[model samples]
Structures are given as C-alpha cells and as structure tokens.
Target: MAPRIGVVTFPGTLDDQDAVRAIRLGGGEPVQLWHASADLKGVDAVILPGGFSYGDYLRAGAIAALSPVMTSVRAAAGKGLPVLGICNGFQVLCEARLLPGTLMRNEQQRFKCSVQELVVESIDTVWTCDFAPRQAIRIPAKHGEGNYVADAATLAAIEANNQVVFRYLHNPNGSEHDIAGVTNETGNVVGLMPHPEHAVEGLTGGSTDGLGFLSSVRRFLSVQV
Candidate 1:
C-alpha cells in the first residue's frame, strides 16, 4: 500500500488542503488529522502546514502546540516518526520542544510574503533526502514570525551535527546563518519557514519545486518499512 500521510488541521489552519493535495500528487494517501483528536489514525507520517493557528493568539503556534493532537505528535516524534512543520507549524515545533530554536518576528518586524529561493544544505534528513546538497528551489514564504534563533551553545551544537537543512539564498527573514529549515538529530522531524505545499504546481502560480518535499517523504517511508 502507498504511504498514508497525515495533515493536521488546527482551527485556524489554512494550508491543510494544499498539503493534502501535495501528498496525493506525490503518490501518497492523504489523511486529514484534526487538532482536537489525539489519534493519528496510524499514518506513516504527519505534516503541520502553514497558517495562523488559534488566530495566532498568545503568539504564533503557541496555543496550537498544546492541542490534543500535538500530544500524540510529540510522542510519535520521539519514536522517530517523520514530521514536517511549515511556517507557523515551525513555530509550533519549537513551542512543543520537538525541535530546537525559536522563531521570532521577522527582522523588519512586518509580515512578508513572496516566492523565495532556498539552498538545500542537508540531504540526509527524512524530509530532504530527495534533494541534492546545495540544490536550490523556489517556494512561497508568508509569515510574521520566521526568524530562527537559539542560544550560542545550542546553535553551535546544531551546526556541529549538520542539523541545518535549508538556508535562504537571500536571507529574506533574517534567520540565523540564513537558515530556512532544520532537522532534528535523528533527521525524522523537520521545520521550515517556506510553504512547500503551496508551490507544488505551476498552475497555482509558482515553481512546482515543493513536490520534491512530498516525494521525499514517500521515499523515506519506503525505506523505513
């Protein structure tokens, strides 16, 4: 059977459908997971898409991180389950302590949205194995908080372990080290500011480069089984 990928939808989530479409287009079954449900329904992987969950109340992704589904997500993630958190989802990952570093407001202190370029820096991660090292791809980035920061020690550790996955070519968000994405030590979880799901098809008005991210999950799942 094809891999069953779960796409979690919080109350304010806007990109869940796009994530589902990307999964189907990449040869996987899309499973709709909800915020209130703790059950993952046995999905092979999960995706936390971009959006202002819980109205971005009390900080972006702060409320959604405590949702029931995230409890299960955290547990599953500890077991090395593949999870990709995009944009606000990246904020949630940090808030949940799933991934290191915190996303703060953009350097300009304003919401930014545009098609952006990223250079893949780590190909060993579960969410990035499909891309070659230093390969560049264009994706959409829309967020008020996407700059990544961590303590000096933590940042050094992350760099030492090659946990940084993608870096913005032009540093649109002022992320540390030009970081656009990162992976956990196990490489099973990844978080990025770019909305790969939104860039799956040119008909939607941007490069179809994001399809590789979804396809990469399929390859990762196949290897796991």
Candidate 2:
C-alpha cells in the first residue's frame, strides 16, 4: 500500500490542495487533516503546506502552533513520524518548537516570490534522503517573513549535527547562513522556507525538483517495512 501522508489544513491555508496533488503524484495517499482535529488518523507522515495560516496575525504561525492538529503532529513527530513543513508551515514548526530557530521578517522587508536556486545540504533526514548532498535544484520562494534565525549556540548545534537541509544559492531572504531548510535531530522533521509543492510539475511552469521532496517521503516509507 502507498504511504498515507496527511496534509494539514489550517484557517487561511492556501496550498493544501497543491500539497495534496503533489503527494498523489508522488505515489502516496494524501489525507486531509484539519487544524481542529485532535488526531492524525494513522497517517504515516504529515506535511504542513505553505500559506498565511491564522491570517499571519500574532506572528506567522503562532496561533496555528497551538492548534489541536499540531498537538497530534507534535506527538507523532516525536515518535519518528516524518513531518515536512514548507514556507508558512515552516514558521509553524518553529513556533511549535518541532525544529530549532525562528523565522523573522525578510531582511529586505519585502515579500519575495520567485523560482529560487537551492543546494540540498544534507540528505540524512527522512524528507531529503532522495536528494544528493549539495545537489542544486529550483523551488518556489514566496513570503515576506522567510528569514530564519537562531541563537548562536543553537545555530552551532544544528550545523554541527548536519541538520541544515537547503541553502539558497542567492540568499533571497537573508536567512542566517543562507539556510533555506533544516531538520530535527532525529532526521524525521524538516522545515524549509521555499514551497516545494509549487514546483512539482513542469506544465505549471514550475521545476520538478520539488517532486523529489514528496517522493523521498514515499521512499522513506517503503524502506521502513
């Protein structure tokens, strides 16, 4: 059977459908998990797609961090269920403390929407194992608060542990160390500023590199058994 990966839907979320489509194309079953729902419905993995969750008030993902769905996501992730957060979803993971660091407003103080070049830095995580380390790929970056920041010690730790996932080739958002993505210590949870779902298909004038992200999860699931 295909892996069941849940796509979370919070109020104001814009890319849930895109995420669902991406998963299906990657040969995984997409399950819609509501923000208010208290359980994960036995999904093998969960993805937090990009959007202005909770309308971006009280910080990008502050309110959504406290959502009931995240409560289950937090628990599931702890038990090694893979979780991938993109853009606003990345913000939520930081707010939920699932990954280290905080997302701040872009250094340029403007919303950036573009196809971005990124180098996959580490393939140790469940969401990135299909990628070769340092492989360059194009993905979509669209957000005003995509800058990632962390304390000195925390930065040193995640770096030392080789958790940094992607780095922007041109450093679009001024993220610290040009970091575009990262993973948890256990390699199960990953968060990135770029929107991989938006780059799943070439017909949409998008890069297909992002398909690897979704397919990697499917590949990860296949290896588990």
Candidate 3:
C-alpha cells in the first residue's frame, strides 16, 4: 500500500480538503485527522494545512497549537516523522515549539496574496527531498501574519545550522532574511509561509511545483521501508 499521510484539520481550517486532494494526487493515502483527536491513526507522515484555525482568535495559530492533535504531532516529530506545516500551519508549528522563530503580521500590515517564486535551498529534509538544491519554483501565498521573526541569536543559529529550506526569490512579504521556509533542527519537520499544496495541480493555473513536496515525503517513506 502507498504511504498513509495524515492531514490535521482544526476548526475553521479552509484547506483541509484541498490538502487531502494534493496528498492523493501525490500517490499517498490521505488520512483525515481531527484537532481534537489525540491519536495519529498510525500514519507515516503528517501535514498541517493552512487556514484560520480557531478563528484566528488569539493570534493566527496560537489557540490551535494547543489542540490535542498537536500533542501527538509533537511526539511523532520527536520520533522523526516527517511533518509539513504550510502557511497558518507554519505559525502553529512555531507556536508549538516544534519549529523555531515566530510568524508575525506582515511588516506592511496588509494581507498579501500572490504567486511567489522560491528557491529550494536544501533538499535534505523529507518534505523537500525530491527537489534539487537551488531549484526555483512558484507557489501561491495568501496570508496576513506571514512575516517570520526571531531574535538575532536565534536567527544566527538557524542560519548556522543550515535550517533554512526555502528562500524567496521575489519576496512578497517582509520575512526576515527572505526566509520562505525552514526545517527543524533534525530536518524532519518543515514549515513554510507559501501554499505549495495550491500549486500541485496544473488546472489551478501554475506550474505543478508543489508535487515535489508531497513526492518528497513519499520518497522518504519508501527509503525507510
């Protein structure tokens, strides 16, 4: 059987179904996971799709980071399960301490929407293994609080560790150092502001660059088995 990848849907998630479709298109079984459920359903990998989780009530992903499913996610990540967190999902990963740095409101204080160009900086992570280092790709980005921030020391550490995975070629938001995505220290978890899942299908009107991300996960699982 193909690898089963779980997509966690918190209340108010707008991209759960789309994420599932992306997963299926990438040749993996899409397992729907609920925020309230503590179980991971034995999936090989997990994805946290973008949306206004918990209505973005207290910050974008702050409330949702505490969901029951996140506990399992944290545990799974510790055990080296690949986790891809996109957009608002990226915010939750930082909030949950699964990844470093914080995503703040756009420096211009306006929500930005655009088809962005990104350079894949590292293909070492599970979510990006299918990509070649320094490959340029286009993906849609829609968010208000997508400006990534961290203290100078933390920022330096991330760079020193080569944790930055994707970088913006034409930066749409004022993310620090043009950081579009980053991997955790262990390289198993990755979070990015752009919506790669939205670009997986050509019918959606863009290059199918997002397939590399999902395909990377499948490749990772295949290697493990």
**Per-prediction count of colliding residue pairs?**
0, 0, 0
Reference-based lDDT, residue 79, model 2: 94
Error of model 3, residue 176, in angstroms: 0.5
Q: Over all chains combined, what TM-score does candidate 3 have?
A: 0.98
Give per-residue lDDT, candidate 3, residue 57: 92
Give the poorly placed runs of model 1, Cα more than 4 Å off. none
Clashes in candidate 3: how many?
A: 0
Which is better, 1 or 3, measured by lDDT?
Answer: 3
- Per-model root-mean-square deviation over C-alphas: 0.9, 0.8, 0.8
Q: Write the per-residue lDDT of candidate 1 for residues 125-153, one digit (tens) a residue.
A: 88888988899999999988999999999
Error of 1 at 179 (Å): 0.8
Per-residue lDDT for 1-225 in model 2, tens only?
989999999999999999999898888899999999988999999999999998999999999999999999999899999999999999999999999999999999999999999999999989988998889999988999999999999999999999999999999888999999999999999999998888878999458998898778888888895
CA shift of 60, model 2, Å: 0.7
Tens digits of per-residue lDDT, candidate 3, 58-81, equal 888999999999999999899999
Q: Which model is ahead, 1 or 2, in terms of lDDT?
A: 2
The alpha-carbon deviation from the true structure for residue 215 of candidate 1, after best TM-score superposition, in angstroms, is: 1.4
